[model samples]
Target: MPDLSHPAAHRPGHGDPDWAAMRRILVVRPDNVGDVLMTGPVFRALRAAAPRAALDLLASPAGAAAASLLPQVDGVVTASVSWQQLDLVPGSDPDAELVGDLAARGYDAAIVLTSFSQSPWPAAEVARRAGVPVRVGLSKEFGGGLLTHWVPSPPDEEHQVDRMLGLLAAVGVPSRGIALEVRVPDDAATPLAVVGERYAVVAPGASCPSRRWPAERFAAVVRALAGDGLTVVVSGTERESDLVHAVAGDVGVPLAGGLGLADLASLLAGAEVVVANNSGGVHLADAVGAPVVELFAGTETVDQYRPRTTRAEVLTRPVSCAPCRQLVCPFGQECLAISPDEVVAAARRLRAVHV
Candidate 1:
């Protein structure tokens, strides 16, 4: 039988950096909100380990908002490249501007974080060009000498939050607690009037279309949740309003437009349960300590993206073509084959457990 298990972190470095001497640090995680959120504990660990040092986050626009909400983060710089996410058209090259910004900041050391399947070299290359002498990242097959230390990462199946903390651990920064955290900034008041005191939030939009379950199924879930004496609210980015509306149908309350990132964080914090696709909402809900009913479509392995909360109930159907890593699913998309009934059941169970 094939051995299916988690991989351990491996370190291939000559010496550990002097954390005491490192004053200014840059954390490069130029992906989406979910990616940045998973890196939150790393930011916290760095602050705890180096209380005197200045920390700045280098992130994509999708990630910048969440980065600002982490109390450990001193500043956030936004730069989204074509390589970061799907549906972004060509010529999205913002590397030159990003590199100039990093070079100007004079970061003493830079740590490039990425998902298991992603290469950290591109961001690490920027750090190298910025004259950051101490660069750290996970070892990759085609790293191009972008990293000074190639640390061993845990198995690809591990939660992204734990994996990020593992990267810091390789450099001798132990984790405080492997929990996802987001500071609810006071500026984002709850979008209350329409929402009940206790409610379930359903986020039905994903950056990649293939990652979403069928819209009608999401509608069925919201309608069912409402029928079961739960107040259901549907949400997403302003760009996702159409998709969110399609999924909400008529039963769920639609707050899909106009809520800013911190506002969304506030909304999630007050939620009883978050029902969402395997998108940024999963990570956001986890960060807010909300129970998640995750309808995880296996465009990638659940190990990389599942919300890091025991309060979560993840529903997925594994297939050989899963972890296809393709933005567009070419297969029958059996990964999204889970029934709405399963999602509803999982939601009720998680809501009950968390309550």
Candidate 2:
């Protein structure tokens, strides 16, 4: 097996910092929505470390939406342009342009988070060019030369939220245990009134098809929960409305596309329980401190990636071909065939414990 722990060249480490004196900081987490959401603790830890520092975030558009609801992030910048779009284009100075734009913000330091498979060097290079003085990240590529401090990536495949907290720890920021937190704006708070006192949110879609439980199975879970007298609010993006509609038609209330990210957070925040696949919504619910019933299809390891919260209950079926990480299942999806009754049972058990 290849050594996956080394950082790529040009990546920097968490340098020696005067925690009290660091005033302006930038966090680069231009990944998926869930990845951005998981970085919430890092933002909080940074704030706890330097209570007066202004924190800004660099993320993709969707990630930016999630970041906007985080109280710890004072400002957000979207890096929507993909690496291929800019890097493959001949004579395009997109990297330089991005660096200049970030440099204009005048951040004193930055922290870049990367998984074993992802190289932090590219983002580190951008931060360096942006003139950020103290850059911090894992040292996988002998890139310690570029960083002021280099911390080893944790060997355990912990939850992404914990992984980000580890990065904060490297920079002298204390972790707030391992939990997700999001702020809901005033306007988003209104939708919660419609959900009433007791309701369950059903998120029926995942970014990858292989991770999604079958739509009908989700419908069954919804119907069962609804039959127990809990209102089931179906949630998904506008693109996922059709699937939400199909599930809602068979099971619960159709609130598809009616909630923005902030509204979704508000709704999840007030819910008694959230039923979702191993998707962003699960992480969002965890962030809001809502109890979650997570259905896993085995493409991703639930042990490693499941939300880090005591309120979360995960259900997975063991299969030899699990963790294949396939986008589309070629064979019949044996991984998702865990009986709907089993899911319902898990929900009932959770509800029982909470009651």
| Residue-wise C-alpha lDDT for candidate 2, range 185-304, written one tens digit per residue | 887743545556778888999988888888888899889999998888888888898999888875577776757898888888877788899888988888888888898887866766
Tens digits of per-residue lDDT, candidate 1, 256-302, equal: 77888889889988888888888888888888889898888877888
Would you list the C-alpha lDDT of every candidate in the order shown? 0.81, 0.78
lDDT of 1 at 190: 84
Report lDDT (Cα) of residue 46, candidate 2: 86
Model 2: residues with Cα > 4 Å off, grouped in runs = 1-15, 81-87, 189-196
Model 1 lDDT, residue 351, Cα: 77
